[model samples]
Target: MHFLNRGRKLVRTAIALAATIALAGGGVTATADRASAAPVTPSPIAQAGTAAVKGSAKDGYQVYSRTSEAIRYTRTYDGIRVYGGDLIVRLKNGKVTGTSVGLAKPLSLSTKPSVTALSARAKATSAFRGKITSSGTPELFVDASDGTGKLAWETVISGWQPDGQTPSRLHVITDALTGAVRGSFDEIESVSGTGNSIYSGPVAIETTANDTGFSLTDPVRGGGYTCDMGNRTSGTCAVFTDDDNLWGTGANADRASAAVDAHFGAATTFDYFKNVHGRDGIFGTGVGVPSRVHYGSAYVNAFWDGAQMTYGDGSGNAKPLVALDVAGHEMSHGVTEHVVPGGLTYAGEPGGLNEATSDIFGSMVEFYANSTADAGDYDIGEKIDIRGTGAPLRYMYDPAKDGSSHGCWSTTTKNVDVHYSSGVANHFFFDLAEGTGVTAYGTSPLCGSAAPVAGVGREKASAIWFRALSNYFISSTTYAQARGYTLSAAADLYGFCGTEYKAVQASWTAVNVAGDDFCSAGNDFTLALSAPSVAVDPGTSGTVTVATTAINGDPEPITFTAGVVPAGVTVSFDPATVTAGEPTTVTVTADPGTPRSSAPVTITATAPSVTRAVSLAVSVNSSAGCTGTNGDDVAIPDNTTVTSTITIADCAVTPSSTASVEVHIVHTYIGDLVITLLAPDGTAYVLHNRAGGGTDNINQTYTVNLSAEAPNGPWVLQVRDAASADIGKIDSWSLSL
Candidate 1:
């Protein structure tokens, strides 16, 4: 197998250019199918306080079957990219068939930010941890992945992790008006190595005959070729050329061996998506993703660089990370990014889900290959022996057996690394495919006393997962959102809440991910917030539109009321009672005396037959003056309380009715710590009481009112570590009075 690696970039660029021209909007631009006439502005629920939702759409890509076609659209609002706002439309012949939208609701907010780009970047800089290399310009957009629209400024902070080896590209989202850090996700997704023409024995691979020799390039599949990196970290790779078309002898020394595995993997994974899911190719438009094997002298990991795939020779340069499933796993990352538009952010719950997605498809592809030398199984990296223990890197049946991965969802699940945190979804998938208790794969333990989930078979499970990924999931999807979307996918595939849907729910519940019985009643309604979040100054007011739609239920009168208003705030809903298809105006007024802080105000919507509640984020602000910070790191001894101090000098002013406490702590599980800010007068305001389930780190801003206290002395940032084994340090803390 021989290929010219020097021309790789140029070929990819040409394919991309063709796709752009075809889509009618270069990679970033979009074209909308807006009607020729002026659009109706009264639709989409956000009927007050904003102008018409101006937007456009461009065809990102499309796929086809015998009689049906699916088109993907990359969208923008007011001239800005919309994160989690992708749309997919399926049609038969010239008629509409189905459609999928990533946005929770339509965008109807100002693109302009109250906070300047400089200010937003500074906020992002603080949220970013580790050593800094460079930063990106702040971009503005509407973050509507959470069922509501928010004007946000996104800043990408690039750097190295604490280890200085693993790089970081953290995208931090900040509220444009309040400057509060809203959300974050990393760019670098990681996975370890394993492979064989060595792992798969002597497998048949496709190659293209060239003037010089037979090259390891598939002419039938977008001319995708596998090249050797010559054991270098980065350089031009050479295609493995051979005198004869036959290649690989089941040895790592033969570079063609790894290339065979990689080439075959790319082909098989492409076939899996095309034959089973109706997706045409990796890019959905016949564009093949190139692969570079033998990436480093002794690299132990492999990764997807957003454009192509790269594999490393493991320890001693004896093991190439090019196993069939490994290749499938790496390429599936590209698929996730391609199919989901922006791909799931590679951090927190989203990252874990993304990793699990790769693993799931990797196993499925192995099964699809049906090679006698390498049988499909639930274990990951088993062929490579990644840990040098003859055991796989992860056991889908019982992930915690590795002593790191989470076997079930918990308060601390989202706090762990993406690889280990992936155990929850991984285990859930196993349960869905093989059922609970014991199976051919292994024994999968139930999270609690939850009922068992019957096997739905791998085909059905995979279809459900793919449907959710392509149709329902977006970039900020959490395990909770995943459960809902998968349920919807299951309903779409099978009948609503039928055996397949119930199996999905039961499997999720068995993994400690609780969800409502959405199909329990035929009558139901959905709620969406026009403005999900707002930053209001003390003595000021902000409004949100509570929009409702009837779902599987008759039109009924729905009553809206405040369920969780802050102590010093008053909430009143205009037209408190309306039909299910109507919208209500919710105004929250923060009194001057209200503490300067943020909390979720729940608006409960009740109908005669059902009840639903949507939460609104509210933060109160005042002029900042009493500011202090302690930047020293304090070791958080297990099960012990540690304190840092910040003294203020504002003698005349008390404190903002709601004051902000920005704390940065590097911890294994911040969910195990109770963090409270103590006033100089000994009054304490609790910020976090062992939250986030099982997620890690406490590096964000928290707000609460400083009540009846003088801002003239030391204000203590107190953290109590209530867990054992895991530990961290209080990196820094700041006070805004």
Candidate 2:
């Protein structure tokens, strides 16, 4: 999940102008830009600091338009680009208007890797088992998601899942120096569900009539076809073909009975996304996804394995995991991954969002189909008695009815399993679409002190969520962010201060998610950081920008200062001050020979009436290495492969030396990756195959005995993505000889 790039224009209001005028303080003057017809002067604020801005004046910051009225400035530290460090300055006809900062403070840390690329790969391998398909070279990354940053190695491992046929792509994050696994997540999204001796009963399905008679394939809908796994574990399954135009008898007694239900489910799901959301297909392309039924003997689950959908038979081969909602649920996983960047990070709050996204759409698909055999409802997996007690797998109307799922948000919400954590969002969606108390779906109880929420209707609710998922929300997004993004989506579709937007806020409140009321204060002044934290090497320095933006108020002067500084580190600001609606640079310097450690530094921007403080993660390290990286972000176009070259000129390493190669790639689907390293002599070493199945990004190192090849020439790194419909990029790479 990532924030989608938008090019909409912002509407300025009189309140914003007044706020700017009121906030301007000493040494700050308000001016108007006659050309742009907006304020051109700085708002009220004071500045204090001694650190002079260093570096070439022309090389300081580069501005690019974000929205029509906002221009973003990229941040750097001692010449090194700061990841996630950027500032957005809103302007109207070249006048200072408002600003939004991405970085909390400058980065001050060590730029060294203590762990070898080979060691990082080994650690990743141990954590990710199964058939090793593709293993990418590890690259150094600044981990700043927690408001503190650290140098970590990210490796992408792809291959067949433990079940063999199911593809698995696993992203492993390791401590760069310690080689300890920090975290990992699978890219494939799956949900447990099932079928029957034709439990769905007779349903209308579209099939292709071929020379071999009617086949269980929908030629009309992206050539989608269903095959039989034959209760086996490996190899390609055969597509179901019948001598006649008719399919299975509505009974488990016939082998094709389950296929009928599976086939119908796929068709309904495809139609749901296409007709309801205007999506072309699962991938938003006119491509059909393959569905395989009869997966393992008594497997009792279904999953969207990154590339295709697979279903299992229940105990006694009596239950096939292919219900209407289950089919929609599994297929929606594909839509979510393809729609969102890195597909919601597959863990924590994002993971729950992923699951809930599927549930929401799955239920919607069921409703769209309106199958009499399995009516659309808030309950999931109710038709399939997976629990043997006629109870559904989950209750979206009142998630807590399941005993483990939470209906409201809490501090511990992220700690629960993704399936349960999803309850919070699921309940919120239900309340938003149908309201509280008695309704068509059922009675939805409010959580905590939240008031009753009015319904926005399912159509509007789904549109709002789909818009948010596609346009807002990025990887590492928290529930609070979801609330904001949903509101933004509603604003885009309905109105900024409209009923839909307010209902979006109230729905989240009903789920106990707070602070979303910020939307209510339209045109209010605000502060934000592009990145919450940053990392720097010892003896080196980094820079961050502070920005102040007015939603609907006058630009004011804002004072900037460092709240906390480590003993060995000093913080300074360029110009030592700033006015609201303008960006100021903050530089952090670490003394030479400083001890390596992590520190949390806070940067505060204060005005006469309001003050905001943001946290920064500073890490100092002692590890060192020789590395090379791609200066610009390379785009890997769909269905095409790209290469990035890392030239190593006069290296002192001998031909017989064992060299470690670290490659870092940021992509959505690791299963499509095939990475190779070419020595100076044109000798190619396969570092990774298309192994990771559906996992996001590749970060791992490969160690090879380059004793036979010279290390002084230009080495080329090649990357190929076998499949289409998804794309990614090679972030950077390093060669430690």
Candidate 3:
């Protein structure tokens, strides 16, 4: 947004020329056809003129004099309609020589010299009007024929559509014309690089030749300088001029690839405007414009000098500041100048507003451009390498990073240096466009807890600011005025009492720029602090933790109140009460916060002094347990011996059930022991137990008997413990059949 740049000065001379374009005062109108007046008759004036006037003047006058109040016209001599100024007949060697006249005014002849000039003047005056319309370029076009539809001149006429940054005027001029087009040039303004370098320049039929550094094969200097793909050097550096023999030394970069990079970057910027912002070029109309790069000696700035964009390679400490953002910034100045009269002048708040306006739109263009090579960020001049310390020119998020002088603005902001003073407004834009929040526009990551606009988000904030910029805020908008304009715009765009309107008011307050009472009455600027919202996973089970914090600006402490915790979830906070200036984390936990399982838990911090609510995402996790059954347990008697029947549990999921269980006993003595299996209900079948004593412990014979009336299912076998040492451990056994 800074106006003083090295390259800008070099092109300073051209500013006056462009500014001299008459600020016409008319609108667009329809032109009438005069094709019938194509032939015959000559005027004494035409005969008095040079032999070059081979055609008939009467017919030409008739053809050219077709009038239309709405149309702008130029000059007409003996009816030969032309776009430029007056016409005159000069005598050379006693013969009619030729004609010449000023393009700004027209000429003709009457019976007397003074009368003829006066008549021509009157006719010119009557035929010409100052009004300009969007006929072709974003410029002021004159009514060459006094609003009549006629060929004003053979000069080339081009058009440009301003991208709303400035007044969209059609550029009209009268000059010697040639090429395929005849009598009048009628091609629409060609837009290259879309919005990158919006201009009306030559439509080169062929592409520019690639510079392979073929000229560098032979060098006058003994020392060789390498031209790598990315390396850039000042075009004024000795090596640049000596090795490459390029004229610009010291201030410009002479890399072989710079031209391509600059061109592509400009093209990308243009495309960004056209594709993203819906602009034809720099101006909304497709105006062919030149994108001059590598300008001047070690120049460290870029600017749109009323007509074209100029870039300069910075000093040793910096590189060219012609990045996409810089390009957008310069082009935006053109837009500003078009829309706001005297926008370029530096004065008071309007000046600061002007600067900030450029920065804001520059950033917007970057955001809109959204190039892969350079993703849009709210940072300015990050790639320029000015400090050689990796600090951008300005930080929209935290302008204070540069210095306090350039940070947030107050009433006294106008007192600071223009560069630093600019920050206050820049910061306001940042705050207004992006609320103080955790995230901005999705990609704009925020610093810890410095949320923009307190309660609202960046998207709404940007919309409010954009509307304010285009609608309510005038060229001389102050911080207070900005607040009001944005509020009104928000209400209009989002509806009265809508979240957006309230958010806009709150955002202005957060930035300390609250507006009048009318807009502020319904808007709340107080921080609406609440706990974090609930986040969930897909499946399984888990817990969600909710943390609470009192909104910083809240007048007093708030009592933490929990909202509906998810099923299988729990909620709590580190410190239930949130004291002023002390933010508390209200933790909401889920017993089994399973994966993909989530619920919304709102934690309201309410008090007579203040009220705030924060939502936490209570979620479950599924990554906790293994896929199958972990382990199993079984029990068997020691002394008694008997075959035990047991069924193992399968690995299938059993939500809230226990595994099957079984018990068995064995006999260790020589005796007639019978083992009978019985169900828990006392049902049994056959019983059989046998023991042969080989080591004198016991000798027994077991008989297998089947009861005819026995019901057989799962049964138990009972046996007695024979050994003395194992007697206490082995409880008694019984057979049920």
Candidate 4:
């Protein structure tokens, strides 16, 4: 079938892209798209290892016509690439029937009944239903595959409802064959399944609450639990525990379920952060941040307001996105706040880094959880379905692969959407921690590169980076600072010249951060000014600018600030800005508070302090022309021809012809430029003149060929100047062959 796939282009081009290095140190196999071959022959079935059973044409029609819960199954036995086909079935009466493949109206085949047939309707029903051992609870064992047409990733369903509905309960059992917990014995019920949370229920609540230090209470259906919201002055508002007599039909019960989901989410998030980055909690210490689920009435989003995390029920389209990754992401903000207490004020590079930290950790958390109900993957926010497109928020393999993300950066990288903008650093982290080729980590083919990691694992790298952020990097940090701090951290943990340090350097380099030169060379100047931090809220626009230091020999004191702010805000920079030096402070102010308080920005400097010209001029002079007389020749025979001349350039020049000559010239270029001379006899002489000369003389020269008697004609001399010519030059030429 000609099914169209939109993600083909980006997925294919992900591997061959070029990467730039950081000044300082640093550093799509498309198998699924192939066409399938046509089936050669179609015959009857033999032994049934896994029966490829086909239903009759009437059965197939009934599958579409019947309202029963029986689901229809279709399998492309060869591969998923083929288009149309038919079904052949054998009935209980030993009657054979064939159905033509047609979407509108299928053709049916008549079958000839056999004399020896099984006459029993009871036996027919028994074939579809597998043997069941446990019967009481909400548990059943079928061909596990029979449960869903084929295998499927499990999804938990939990929540609350009215009094008549069944109370939520637990169910767990192992598959008879695989021993996997494919079917659950527990069954729970609520009033409305729409409001039910997947991560709630007994097991999740108990396990999650125990994992976190928080305590759990009875399923307070419709009751708002009381918890301290920290300081009220800073907008840290707390909710009072109240069991309202009148609540949404079963929203309160569902909200309780949401609370359990939140708890489980917190547990997974905490474990991921600690296990991955060695961070104790959001605060690096053992301080756990409180997450209140079902914050307001259908408040679609989940956010961390500088203090604690809050989750809200989504509208009709989406569910409450308290998934592990999302919870980890929101909680990461609190971690960032604790780490860099100054907030996202220090905009630009640092701000971008801060935002990216959350995304990176979020992906890491998903990777750690590794739950089938919510399998770990690089795709961000897929379970939440925030976009309703069945895709994800951002793709790590190719951020732009989903068409909603930025993918990579351009000169105007700062102008993209913040969600997309976060891609720049995300790409850096991926390429840095992982190298340029395909990785063999057994991960989904999403990340095209074969090299999952360059030198060390992401765990070590993240650990070092976290240490760097907590110990070395400040609130107003820049990409440069991050590179350095990370390198330093890696160095401290793995040794200065270890693979981890090199990988860290390489990753930043790939992301286009010129690490070696992020800082001014030779100039030891510190700027209190750093990259501004940012926060992107649902319906608000905020802007922040980061000021740059003036280079001593900067043709002019150029005021640097990012311009052409995105739609959300009218972001502006200052001097409208330049802080001349110490004591001269340049302030980057955001106008009219944003819908969300924090928004991220990344500022980089294209110009640096020190300037040194690396241009050199070279010159050389030797034999101008050669003259052969009878004085040196014992016999100047009749047809005998003699010639000699030395031609030289500013750099070393070799005589190319049988006749030798050196012509004076300048080698104002770097590297080796070739000199060639062709003799009249069609013979050519060549030499490679290496370019570096301290005294501005011939570094190396050679007289190619010498002949007492040579053909007498104007010998052609060709000088092929070397490509890399920054330190030397080429001048006059003379030749005789």
Q: Which of the numbered candidates is closest to the native, going by highest TM-score?
A: 1
Compare the candidates by lDDT and give the number of the best one.
1
**Candidate 1 lDDT tens digits, 1-737:** 33456533211110100000000000222334422345654211122112112122321222211223454555567667666665555444544433444443345677778899998898778766689889999989877655456889999999966645445788888778767666677766556643332476555555665566577666666777778888776569897777667676656777777777777778788778889888766767666657788877677776665666777778777877667777677677777887676777666687789989988988998899888777889998777777777788888999999888989898667657788888999999999999999899899999888898898999999999998887756666788778877887897799776999889999999999976446646667777554457666667877666666565758789998887666688889888998876667777888875656668888898988989887788767653455766766688999999999888775345676666788877676667999988887788888889875455677667657675677789889899999897787886788877
Cα-based lDDT at residue 286, candidate 3: 52
Worst 10 residues of 4 by lDDT: 19-28
Off by over 4 Å in 3: 1-256, 271-279, 316-318, 437-463, 517-737
Clashes of 3: 132
Residue ranges of candidate 1 with Cα displaced over 4 Å: 1-29, 38-186, 192-197, 520-538, 541-553, 561-568, 572-587, 595-645, 648-661, 665-712, 716-737
Alpha carbon lDDT of each predicted model:
0.71, 0.66, 0.38, 0.39
lDDT of 4 at 422: 64
Taking the tens digit of each residue's C-alpha lDDT, what string does model 2 give over 663-710? 666676677888898887899988888865555566566666666776
Instruction: Give candidate 2 regions above 4 Å deviation.
Output: 1-112, 128-151, 155-169, 192-197, 519-523, 526-737
Rank by TM-score (best first): 1, 2, 4, 3
- Cα shift from native, residue 122, model 3 (Å): 36
TM-score of each: 0.75, 0.63, 0.37, 0.39
Error of 4 at 379 (Å): 1.7
